[model samples]
Target: MKLSTNYLGTVYQFSTLKEVLAKANEEKSGDRLAGIAAETVQERIAAKEVLSNIMLGDIRENPLLNPEEDEVSRIIEGQVNERIYQSIKNWSVSELREYILHDDTTGEDLKRLSIGLNSEMIAAVAKIMSNLDLVHAANKIEILTKCNITIGQKGTLASRLQPNHPTDNVEGMIASLKEGLAYGIGDAVIGINPVDDSVESVKRLLHATHDFIQEWQIPSQNCVLAHVTAQMKAIKQGAPADMIFQSIAGTEAANRSFGITASMLEEANQLAKVHGTGTGPQRLYFETGQGSELSAEAHFGIDQMTLEARNYGFARFFDPFIVNTVVGFIGPEYLYNSKQVIRAGLEDHFMGKMHNIPMGVDICYTNHIKADQNDIEDLGVLLTAAGVNFIIATPMGDDCMLNYQSMSYHDVATLRQTLNKKPAPLFEEWLEKMGIFENGKLSKIAGDPTIFTR
Candidate 1:
């Protein structure tokens, strides 16, 4: 099966409502920064403005748009929203009532809490779903999500699925799935961990993961982050990490991850279509780096294989699609007042925005081991120094950050906090630098400006 889900067609997307009024009658929205009012006291007003700000945009830049990438075509991307009742469509109706009312600080008794959905948001999402030819594909577009059982702390998403749920979360499994179905989620992404670079284990794990996907009520896909452990180590040691990755003399685990990854692709052909999203060739993402990024030869080889597989393409094997990345947000592992070194991985890699084919960043934690505030800030500084782009977060912008999901909002907050601490960037002015009317053409407002400042 060629994993060809690129944006061959159009998709619908828009800006947050606040952007509209500022731009209405061509009123100056000033800069992206000027939009923040310091506090969101009247949310209802935000909804009405959303309608005005909501306009047609292309899927090529929208990460949620089905991309040619098998992974993108099948995964759901977005920070959660409870500001609107309509956000209900994003979750199953029954499930919404379950956690809809719980305060972000309550900390426990998940089932008993009521976490409300942003009704207006759901309405908007529903309207989008309805227009996607729901009548024809609703039945075929099975929606579902799978969580990684491994996670930070005992009270986080990863913890909830602990014990037997080590591979996937069981506590919210049903509800998450129901939400997907409600919002027309096509599939919940189940990512393969420890892509041990082994031929045998990779093959087995692929089979196991694919099987897991098939069992779900909705169509599903598997995600594997191309983690270059050796590269990472090398970068830290300031030595050649790619050599360790490519010339692995005794790294059996690395071999297993690659092997399983390859097998997963091969197995997709034999398995029922339900498990994976595409049919011909699968697209694979290779991380970027020199001391760590796969050598040109390694990347070339993978690209050649993908091309030989039917031209479905390989990421990092060539110029990447404008969108597509591995990124994540991390909350403080512990509440310490200390700080450490932080690094931004890439310039293009960013969070807080979606593009056709699940664009953004693929990320994993490095100093997540109970670093102090100063340490975390240092980490951000390091990432900024390193040029990392995306950072995940909780839905409502809470203190837990992305790790614990305690009312977190915008993984990009890392960038904001990082920038705020270091240099006084004219973020709003900078955001305006790109989107002003360039000749007769208007550049689309993209990800938050902070994602790129590093």
Candidate 2:
């Protein structure tokens, strides 16, 4: 393929598909740290021009990571709808982007179009799209999946109520849980990132959250973010769980670092379907982020954005209830600062939607990063505008256990009101029944956690 281009009369050349993909990416500290990013803005634009002209079939045929060597590559390749792919194989990446943005391309058309796309193609189009382009195209599609209640319906936003306690204290967690419920959050799931990964700790948190849901008749799901094996063991010991939770990466080596394999994920999925508490065909929950593979020393010379898209490709196999990117939690080495974080958040959401997964985002950042709650709050609003299915909500946008700031429970209520969106349909019904929401706004009693005491 022609990998040379001229930008402003300067010749720019990249050596391989992987190099072109990496250099074409928006400025990311992670890619630069990996020594893969283009050295100049003009060079980056040159790479984008070269990439836009490349055909979808060429990207598919020239695998960045060989399927024979990487299971993630294999799984993604194995699932391609060959007939559909053949039809679009000759289209340039620029044509694909224009087709998606065309006024006549309906959400259903995008859904069908997703079947023919591989992860690399998704990442390629995203690389060339402007930030607003990402938002507008992603807003055109809606992806809804069910766990206990459905999420991702049109004009609906959901939140994962994260009541993390540093010591796995059930009462402290319940206090936070009650506070989140007071604001009409937790429609997506009451997911906890426990300080302890022990099966006992995981089970204890799962049972606590599950019992509270039953007590209040809340229309939500519950999950404890532990290692997949610990969650599996807890399920075997009869812990009440609505879904299985695991953090996945884009490469087989990276997944191994997380102590997971395709087989392991499949096994956990089957167990959740047979034994977990949720009522559905969708019961798996996955969290992915940019730069995870690099952190684990398993990036294999590919850019982080492409790696993140590979995550969704792998996740689609099990028909997950929810899959989200922890967009900025990996620190500044990967994303750098607020500008990078915001750009990555938009790109990740758009790419995930392009993969046709029920995608959400943990719009978050670490203290060390040059980002604050205000930056993520801005992202929350943008994602809400983009029709993101859900966002991670913590008490006052602070997670004491994970030591990061996310969107607050109050932020969830605000975004819904500000944007003329509502919580999930079943969740809104429960909110009305409990008098927490009324007349399309939070009621007078909405912020009172004590109401649940009665």
Candidate 3:
């Protein structure tokens, strides 16, 4: 009921929940560009103070985007457990944050807590959490999802081999794919970002990666990141897809801009269930980022962080096998530099995990974002330490097709070895059998694409 807070002998009052949410966020160019960020550091702290004391029930009742107008809101609302909500409806955001950070709180407790809270509550708590607090809280939770292989088990890290090409060249993608596999990557998936989003091109790439997995008897899944409609058409026409992929946003209007709707996603999920090549019920892969809603002009004055949390809320509805945020790929406009990218990456991973989704991060940056490979490499290490399910890797961290840099095959190997982690269980076994990995480390033949050529 109260939207005013006193800090350092000054009174700060926010007129609406949206204003408080935006002002409470850490400095982000996207928010500033949207003209909603706090005007001063003291104002930012005051907003956090106001937000922390706001009740969970108040957030739920306020509904930033009306469910009547937004399907994302409806989806998130439908998923909240009413019984669980009543039990924690009176808890303040600060109370919830501390409860999550409390040493006595177990992973199961957090899981149960996730059921009671909605995306707004999740985002609210994240605003007040420091970087390490986000990591520490997220590290307590383990979310495991299975496609062809299980990912996100404790002590295991996974990688999605993105073998993108400038012209949809199969051989060029295969070159990168073979090299990545040699380094014990691609356990999460051999996913590609196609230069072509056509059904035929999608099918071609899917078949290429699928056949390679079949020939090598590799323990992994494959996807081509085309439009959901293109993938659906390809799958219906008998494309051998291990998983269906789509990029999702936080609002109905943004989703429309992406050419998706809840019903359309539901149809895609059903199609994958019957026709997808993966082994289980979880077959959808979604990529979300912080600034997507704002980019599409659908944020409705809300901050990017809250919109991002809404993404996880929507993603969990379909029970995705894997979900990742391309944290820095939207460029410096959304996340200005390494510091903002790192903060957003950690926030996204933690928020996704809090939503109980299999969360990964594309620790990445565009060339013009005042960030280099080293910045993303630092993020890759941080996310891995926080028990991220997987990360996106390109050949030498360069995606010639997308013109962005992410973590690399070599970085995946380094993260695994340095942090005492392994790939997904079946993938690790296949690696050891292929002599790419031996005794918990890469073998002599590792990092050689020629090994797969034979």
Global lDDT of each candidate: 0.24, 0.94, 0.93
lDDT of 1 by residue, 42-149 (tens): 322332234323321211123221334423122122212224323333343223222322344222332112122111222222222211222221111111112211
Instruction: Please tell me which model should have the higher lDDT, number 1 or number 3.
Output: 3
lDDT of 2 by residue, 1-454 (tens): 7899888988887889999999999999999999999999998999999999999999999999999999999999988999999999999999999999999998889989988999999999999999889999999999989988999999999999999999999999999999999999999999999898999999899999999999989999999999999999999999999999999999999999999999999999999999999997799999999999999999999999999999999999879999999989989999999899999999999988988999999999999999888888888888999999999999999899999889999998999999999999999999999999997689999989999899
lDDT of 2 at 113: 91
lDDT of 3 by residue, 175-288 (tens): 999999989999999999998899999999999998999999999999999999999999999999989999999999999999999899999989998999999668999999
TM-score of 1: 0.26
Pick the winner on TM-score between candidates 1 and 3.
Answer: 3
In candidate 2 the C-alpha lDDT for residue 321 amounts to: 96
